[model samples]
Target: MGSWERPYWESTVDSGVPRAAQRSGAYRRYLPDAIDGMALAIDGDLSRDVAVVERKLRALNGPGAEGLAGIARFLLRSEAIASSRIEGIAPSAQQVAIAELGQSESVRGVSEQAQLVANNMTIVREATTELVVADKVAVEDIVELHRSLLPNEPRHHELRTVQNWIGTSDWSPIDAAYVPPDPDRVVGLMTDLLRYLNGAAHAPLVQAAIVHAQFETIHPFTDGNGRVGRALIHTVLARRGLTEQAVLPVSLVLATLTDEYITGLDSYRHDAAPGSPPAGMAINAWLRTFVTAAEIAVEQSQQLVSAIEELRERWTERLAEYRMAAGLRAAPRADSAVARVLVHLPEAPVLTATTLARILDVSYPAASAALDELRQAGVLATKSIERGTTAFIAREVLDLVTWSERALASTRFDTRRAEPVRPVPARPQR
Candidate 1:
């Protein structure tokens, strides 16, 4: 009646540690049904934490969070960037945004690091959409997600065929921070994890915490485990119908607190050990960290939404000023460069005249004119990344995106810790 444990032969051909035990505690395969001494019971305090996180998330994607979908897209970019950082791949959010917009091939394949995050972004978004309709997560669903992220890898859509360890600097697990169940046991362990996903054994947040930590423990895939494991967090939210459209940047929050995040996973593995501690006490500690991280993620995301909305308001004022200055105060059509660029700023924080024209459905001349106006109004800044190509930077949006990630990852998790949007520069005195 022990929490599920798997056997790994020590001193085997691929064994990192030189021992002779046919089975070891490090290789225990966890199951969804139950643990020997750890039944997932929600104590009163834990219940409160779960309720708060669920309620916050429910409100974020619910009716209360209006006009946020546009800015929320930016949060998705932030998520991809921050999640990528967790795996030690740091790419500017602007580059990732350009890739996501599908307008620039220059950023594509720039480096393996950037590409991995872009792939994960695609996988997470696609998987979220899939889980919405399926109402449950399946193994095939996971495979497709993995394949999408690491299409060229040997085990792209399949489980790892060899053992994988975390925090190992070399080809040995002896000094590794954590080692998962053996490769042969990945399928069965994943099955049990999915069973828990498809069950009502716990609240959505708690179940998600267990599913994520357990997925990390199983370490099913050889590559992209961290990204996929993070994506599964959203899968749980989508399946439970908690997040209608809001993709909470939970990984961004976790990335800032690396030690706390990893420790939570370690707790998940050790606390559920047979007879180690009472089910509630150990599980409660881990769940507390999970729920708190989630709360911070949502709160910071909300602050981001507000910051974006405020930027939009400035855009509105700037547009009116431009119209009045141009003697078009009574103009019936708001089809000027100011209006067009403002609308596209949220999703496309970085753009060029050629691409801007295509996105705004306007002529090259019009897009150029709009860019000119944006530059004059301090709405967009310009940077030359390559010859004959000027990148129009949405400073407000870009600042908010990158700054929010730093803020979330640091000790400050976006709770009323606001950084005012940079104001538009006034025209020089005549």
Candidate 2:
């Protein structure tokens, strides 16, 4: 079957047009068991639910009111991943450019794709935040998110004024309901899903799973359905207060199991028979997969966080031993700010001195001094000029950030590495 064909669903349309039909796929036969288990789990007492899942998350927290501390920790780390590429970082650099859209704080190199990523992140962040408060996440909200994600790209975010479909030839199945829905159908399905989502009784995980599956099946919006759909998962969980902080990095999990992730969706699209169950069973299986992934991601993230904190502490001890300058003590602080700026350097390696001043919260000269120090330290290099002004680039810092990011990416899947701990010697007091 082609990319358009749902795995288990038989194609009814000979014309190469996608159309939905009653699912007779193998997935339909087994969905009931999955759904029943999920419903039972969700309907159980809040305490039990917390015991099963929240306990794993709780271990990541230090103390009181650290609500959903797992998710919060995940969000910060994920943001690091999202913002890394703008600084000319690797791997995520491409994904970041495709996802985030905003100005960098430091003067650094950035590419067109990095700009795209910065824009995407801004849109995702705003939309997800709004979703946390709103009862129903509307198509309009999604449109707004898309607009934010691709501000300059008109075709990407614009609503479909004309009909669109996924299929190839004269045999397009108009009667089959399994194919991706048309634009009008897409809007209707999303509206219905949102209504279901806003209801009081629906379990958050179940609701999230349903919405994600339906959105994928609907394939609404010309582009970014996948990213937006994924974003919706976080929105629902956050809105329900399942995560005290943005601890769940679902994308990292999904990105890791790329093939199985797609196959799960494919199974749903094909096996969901009309007038049967709500595809809840197939969807629940997907959720189970997701839950497992989430558990693994949380564990990995906790390790990473511990590693970073430990690394920082070791560096602190080392700095004391080496008698490093106070300025060097501030270098780690620059990691976040400098990393943000460098991720944007793929498109253009220029930021106005005034902008740098605002970002670094220092005077132009101070910002310039920081740039000069970095340049002298071989961490950054000077790029081109605009109107007799200079722009700087962070080559080594970007490399370091990218190297660190690989650790995050490595944890995206099932592969686990022992957390690297730096060995620091005892410092002799003067």
lDDT of each: 0.66, 0.49
lDDT tens digits by residue: candidate 2, 1-430: 1123333435444443344342234211111111211332332443244356546554454432232232233233344333332343322432232222135433234555545445555555766788788866676887786665555557767566433344432343333333454355455556666776666455565566656766766666766666667777777767766655534665666765667777777655534345443544445556666666666656655654454444334434543333345444533454544434333332223354555677657677766765555455443456553445565653322332343334435533322463222211112121
TM-score of each: 0.75, 0.58
Candidate 2 to truth, TM? 0.58
Pick by TM-score: which candidate is best? 1
lDDT string, candidate 1, 1-430, tens digits:
2255454425434455334322333343443333312366667977987898898888887532443554555555545554454354466666565555443534333455556566667766776677657856788888877766555565445888887677633344544566677677778778777877887667788878888887887888877887788778877876787777667777656766677887776666653555686656656777888888899887877786677778888877776676678776623256775576776687678788888888888888888877877776667788775666677887677667666655654555532464322221122221
* Highest-lDDT candidate: 1
Model 2 stretches with alpha carbons more than 4 Å out: 1-51, 58-109, 156-178, 200-203, 243-247, 266-280, 322-430
- For model 1, the superposed segments whose C-alpha errors exceed 4 Å read 1-8, 12-39, 62-89, 99-120, 155-157, 167-176, 182-184, 199-201, 270-275, 330-341, 352-376, 382-392, 414-430
Q: How far is candidate 1 from the true structure (C-alpha RMSD, Å)?
A: 6.4
Candidate 1: residue 312 Cα off by (Å) = 1.2
Error of 2 at 415 (Å): 5.6
The residue-level lDDT of candidate 1 at 130 comes to 77
